[model samples]
Target chain A: MELDGNSSRGKTIASGVIPFVFVIILMLYIFGPGSDLLDLGIPLPEITIEKIDFVDSEIQATVRNTGPISVEVVMADVNDRIQPAAVEPDKSLERFETALVRIPFEWNAGEPYTIGITIDDGTRFEKEIDAAAPALDFSLDLVVFFAIIGTYVGVIPIMIGLLWLPFIKKISRKKYHFFLALTAGLLLFLAIDSIEEAIDVSDENLAGSFNGTLLVVTIVILSFLVLYYAGEKLVKQANSSKITKHVAIALMISIGIGLHNFGEGLAIGASVGLGSIAFSTFLIVGFALHNTTEGIAIAAPMSRGKLMIGKLVAMGLIAGTPAIFGAWLGGFSYSPFSTVIFLSIGAGAIFQVILVLVKWIKEQDTVLSSGAVVSGFATGISIMYLTSILV
Target chain B: MMILVLSVIVGLSVIAILPVMSEAQLKQKTFVTHSGSVIQTTGEIIDPLYTVSSVEFDPEEFLRNFEYGRISVSESGQTIRDYTIIAEDDKIQEISPGVFFNIWSFNGTVPGPTIRATEGDLVRINFINNGSKEHTMHFHGIHPAEMDGVFESVGSGGGQFVYEFEAGPVGVHPYHCHVMPLEEHIVHGLYGVFIVDPKEERPPADEMVMVLNGFDTDFDTENNFYAANTIPFYYQHHPIQINTDELIRIYVVNMVEFDPINNFHLHGNLYKYYPTGTDLIPSFYTDMITLSQTERGIMEFEYKFPGKYLFHAHKVEFSEKGWVGMFLVNDNHEKNNQEIENGT
Candidate 1:
């Protein structure tokens, strides 16, 4: 460990905080599977429309309500021609419940019909009825819907980013080179993941023209240039202190991650709106676990620099808050185009961070350890790859 | 030079994807038919103009606990039974959560309270209009046009009008605002049931009153919202409990305007329909019953099984729009204890 006297307090505090965090995560992983504690009711109930289906000329909506508020369902139409609807749990809905409210109506198959229902608590719900034309539910119930979506998308990235501060405070000088390679490896995998997602989103455009391929190539190169210039600007902006330079780079990296996370948030939110609950849960767990490595990437730049608790918090918010905002927007009003644009920005920014890492290794007087660097990169890649597979 | 080339390519790609992508998305959102066929639409497409539905009655359970501001008192030395109903306005009550309806109520609610008494009771209705307009309450039972609340016999806003009449035949009928240009007056939430029980004691049973009405929220001739009670979807959420094998007497009155007639259909149960309270014998044993505007009746049915019985208009349009409700028939208490007795 090589911490100067000036920053020993930060190192000491971070050391204490991270171990406590690890112990809690470890305890949950070990005991949670067998515990009944998670079954306890959520005090505040929230509900969202997951999917709307029209089967056999009847309209039905699948709603997910988390927490403990009771809800009732009824359908009202313009002509008042709704067939009687069957509401499950015909009484009060318990918290942490999902219900499929079947609103059957006798209508012309192609005729446009709309069902509006107002709940007793003064909240109103209006849904357009299109047979098999699934639209995301727009109602008062969706406000809490977006909040939950934000939680699923943001928690993982923010938690993982914040986790690195304590452990990376004072890596031994001997192991610093190894950790740098490891950080590069983690970031490289992120850049790849981001670009792959961006490409996947743009796949819809592949049939029309060569635009998709062009978009991929252009963003990857553009992000590298942007980040390269950003690094140079950080150097020029430095106040002759190593700490200042490191902090600037770290902040820039956080900004890059924030952009990428926002794109990820959009994907998760849209998935929920599309009523793919199983897929949404899978993405949440996979992304959160994968995000566990981002901490190393952000911390690597500041390995030998002064780090304040407040500064680390600022980094976390800069990196993580965008995910929340992104998920909320995604769940509420996400379009496919927004997905491609933001993810492109992310892919570009991360590519920039990887270049900064290479520059760091070359800045040294002696040649970097190639063997340690190669193995560290492999280890880092395998860790992230394995996390993705396992999750 | 390479960066410049890349920037130009990115810019061109963005422009290419924006229009094509957005158009596809709009098409995707609008293509809602079950056939899953994409139908192209444009910005110039206008939605079909719709009319406001008739008087929208809130859910039945919404007014279940409410009395039509019952101010009627049986006084000692008064041969004329005095009934006081305030023709009040501007009381914004929540029929559903956060959904407020402006009701021009007699007393404090739409379909002002049901005034019950024996036949031949002198029904002296004191109509006070605390409203901003003229108001009147006309008895559906036999009454002269002067006491009918029509013509010049109207209570001005912030004034009072006293109507004295002898209750005629024993029957279930609706008393409503009979002010000329009748549709607007009655639909303004000024109507109620006046049940005059037969002099010979009728068979005792659990009873409820259902007033079928619709609302023209936009004041257009079309009735957009409809309900059995004043609040829509009330009985669906908070179901009316009925014990199995219990006779349920229902006094249903159709005060709905815009539509000529409305039907009351009960799912999983059938009832004896009486077009008028005058008949001791029911008109028929049917699952569905229909009543015309201002036509009131007394109906009875007994649920034989334990389950949720849906009651709504047979006309699918009227029932689904806002006139839907449920009666949850519970198992008899004594029946549940039989299993304990058997120790099975």
Candidate 2:
């Protein structure tokens, strides 16, 4: 990578001196007069309140030491009153270590309270709770609330997208392959989106010791192989006609979309649990708009088949109900590991469905690169991108 | 060329900025060495050697000291010792460099004052709980049921109780808070070494107390730092100064909670190990000894030569996490005497 003799010489000198500089620093630190440097008294002891939970007659706050030096919580006060507070384990928190400071105060529900924590250096950190309410727990009311969210974001929107089935069925035979290609495009977008989301979640929340990226990659490959094997076995067993194969493809597409919607449900539910997002009409509308197009992707595959009313309802349920379960899991116990697992599996399933759809499209009499098929693919991706903005 | 000139400039600048950068980084490193075995923390760290200097509590002073209390002859001709222990929870101590822990201590010190007495002496303890929470000192030696420090919980805010008992079961024992959720009280530094010396005193030399302890700084049910006498690496920084070929007796008490067991290993020497100091005769001769929570023993050893020797927890994790120390052995008695004669 050397450009010229001067540049290469410069590079060599730079690399050599870096180690030389490091050794000198090390020697100075160990044997030199270290007291002056140690007594430099650099700024330290940064702390922050990570979370606050109001238990029965108690306000437990998770506080983290974000500074270079360790800090101790010397005292705690609530509403200008010195409260009997016990910092779990001990009051001193090493750098980045979190301590739960529990204060025993008889606080009224719906009342406002301010908590102040004073460290050993006399520096105090104050956090105000707008309203004192019991921390979120599994309850009947919470279940209904999450179900309503699932219905709006997952079930109802998907069912509305399924209304495209009648119009899709009435189309000419020449346009049948175009709709199938569009379905493939939709599944492809979903696969990439879910995998991208999984990677982000893994990076942010998974433990450093665990190879989270590798875990996602492995899970995706395993799920893809498993789906492909299962599909191949079933098709060979049935010795299925074109109609039966098309029906299987449609079912697979529904299941794939269902998994993607489940991950979507998880995000919505976890946001509520973390209190990062509040329940709002606008958010629900945004989610509903984002997911409405999934139904069309699911319906496009079934257009060639003579689907019964019962089967149509069953497909919709298969493409929707998992979201309800996902919301329940996420709202109650939202773990990033589980979120990563589900998203990776959904991405894998979508990828396998896309593979099946592409093979089916190639079997058609028309060229795979025809204008209709190419435009259908482009249009499908464009629709997903446009709707994704709402989310 | 431009590249050569730029490279030289950069190198010179790096060298020029070296001292400032190293000073900033040295404070953040837990310990610095040539091989880069440094724990890079977020910010500046206080010097471990000087950390206790800022605080009133000194681990070296705590070592080898015994609380004999108010000695009195009772009407029954028995020796009576009256000791008043004020339990407080608000005291903050630097357990390590840059790490401060709110220690629930007796008389404002972790491991309290090493309460020592001859066997069969009448030890009367005036217990006062001045903390915000309830606390009761439970001694591990033989005592009456009423004086057990349990059953009758001492309330907070100037609560008082008198524990009168005959010191028996000659051994080194741990005395700690006996409140319900006892681990919570003990882990927060509510424990101390209780020594009931045998009436027939053993051969004395240089005696010191080494209370093996740990602090779970993050409340994560696991210990983040471990130490002897509450301060991690204190003995290592200021190695315990001892004369060569002199008998050294250590009353080692293990008060680490969460972990099942802890151990002590000495470098370059084996000690006469007394199991709990209960028996006069030495039980085993070994370089290492393991003790569970609250289990303590007496160790007697003498350094044959003059040099620095290391003593630490045999459990590698414990030692690596700060339960290590050193003994600075001196063979300079003749030199010191010569200097004294010369008056230099």
Candidate 3:
């Protein structure tokens, strides 16, 4: 069927509108702007303290799943005695919540007192602290969470804005090239920034031989390759189907985005698991914003196809599931090696998708000029910078 | 139709004959003394360390001396008997320090009497907690959350409860203190290594039981609470001797207040550490395996050398506090000459 101007216009507007609205809602949820309704008392999850180590200012307990459905621990307040008090508390305490939980509390060097857990759920769990167990040297979990939050909140919006301008607006070829150059510069900056954050995280490692500088570079390269190949294969396969083509492409893009999101979640989980919640919170907000853009990107291709609402939702989920899984996995298992492997694969897939998109734009030879592309790329970079500053 | 009938017949026949074969093998066992003690305090075995430096203790110098033995309990109290346990580093060493009172145990094994029950049969254990502490038995890896003696149902310090659950899977299962934060109770010697024999009869190699018990003690104190009591305050270290090429099954139980991450390294033998104590996964291989508190790991290895092999806690500090022990593997038919090198 030939493409109709009205339908195409409607699809484009809808694709952009849906994600924009979602982003607004997400922002409200994150920033609690414009209303107290956002903080409506949703019965927060409860944590029960089992034991406390007075020497280390650490509390060992089970976070009971007393809620109807499993909830994620977005934040927690620990005592000052904890050496590195930051912790990423993100995990779904399965229904009827009875899981072994251990958290370190920071205490004054020679102080003796009970430790309590002011969980994200708003309930406090405490125990009479024991004078035994060793003190927690540092929590690596929080470091990862903060790094992820930084990248998501600080790096992703600009990327979305960059993609938007060139593709949506009609611009000159030369200007688009300039925009692309700008984007390349911005990406280099982001990559370097991420590496620096990674190095900072590594410095906090009290256990194991993990060098952040080495790890960040390794993750970036690995992520680049995994995303690149996987995206290429997916796009190639989806391109062949005329009937399911649009949906398939959308799904492919979503999957890649989802994987990336999951990696971000892992970073959050690892940080929280290691007791880095403040940093992880930043990561969550950043990721939540970046993910909204990712949602839009996945929907854009399908919107052009004039697909049904069901298909769009399905595609959205295909992209979203990875984030959910990643968030849970990151919170559950805080293993750096595993996180690195996952992040590498995700980065690789994203790299591949971008390449395919660039190639497709070139082949179309449409009225969309190079200048618009350049402008779009620059916008993406500028937005990221602005968000980073604001954050 | 014929194939279905044949399969059914085979299954039924196998079920009928499996328990008979297991009973026959149980009769072939003899009495022996392991390196550790087998006391009658409460109904459970106290301080049942499988491998010790010496079985012969100087009664004069040592305030207390006891031989390694086993206690078997049936529904009736009259069936109780003292079974001698042999200490062999090559063969599996059997030590039950976690089984608390009133539960009928096999030769004083913690996991009450290894009762061979068929799929349709009910394994009834009328156990009593005669020990100074309250204790309860909870089956591990069993479904039906109620029967899984977790939560607050399992009591401690002379507390008694009956656990009746269907025999689902046939494999080696464990039963221990399901009450309290098990890390501390199990570490204080309140667990037992259990086995649910399969319906199929397998070849019998020289069988030995070795229970790996993690202890947290205060050596400076004089107390009879074997759970937190000091390790045998005899000397610096104790050597456990074994023979070469022996097929050994080590039933490792970690009963410590804290999870004792142990790495059981054999000098020259590669061992298979079973995560769930059954369905051995070869790839989950490691010289140093970390056993969580209240968890059990059963490993099988063949010793190749005929010399003094050191098997101690990977946490090097444990040795200075008496966490180090030795294994002497001698050639076949060669009596351990080093046995006399250190006077008993």
What lDDT would each prediction earn against the true structure?
A: 0.66, 0.80, 0.46
Tens digits of per-residue lDDT for model 3, B259-298: 3354445555567777655553544555677656556566
Q: Which of the predicted structures, 1 or 3, would earn the higher TM-score when compared with the native?
A: 1
Which candidate has the highest lDDT of all? 2
DockQ of candidate 1 is 0.08
Each candidate's interface RMSD (Å, one decimal) is 14.5, 14.2, 20.4
Best by TM-score: 2
Model 2 chain A worst lDDT window (10 residues):
A75-84
lDDT string, candidate 1, B1-344, tens digits: 99999999999999999999988776432222223333233311111111112224344443433232233444653235567888876777654333355667877877788877667666777778888777778887787778877764455666778887777688888888877667777876889888877768688777888888876654557665677777655676667888887778888889888888898888887889888788888888998877888887888988888998888887877765568788899988785577578887
The structural similarity of chain B in model 2 to the true chain B, as TM-score, is: 0.84
Question: Please, what are the lDDT tens digits per residue for candidate 1 over residues A222-321?
Answer: 8678777877887777756555877877787787787777887777776555444434567667767777677667777776677576777677667766
Error of 3 at A142 (Å): 16
Q: Put the candidates in TM-score order, highest first.
A: 2, 1, 3
Off by over 4 Å in 1: A1-391, B1-79, B333-344
Q: By summed lDDT, which 10 consecutive residues of candidate 1 chain A come out lowest?
A: A74-83
Stretches off by above 4 angstroms in model 2 are A1-180, A191-199, A202-391, B1-31, B34-56, B332-344
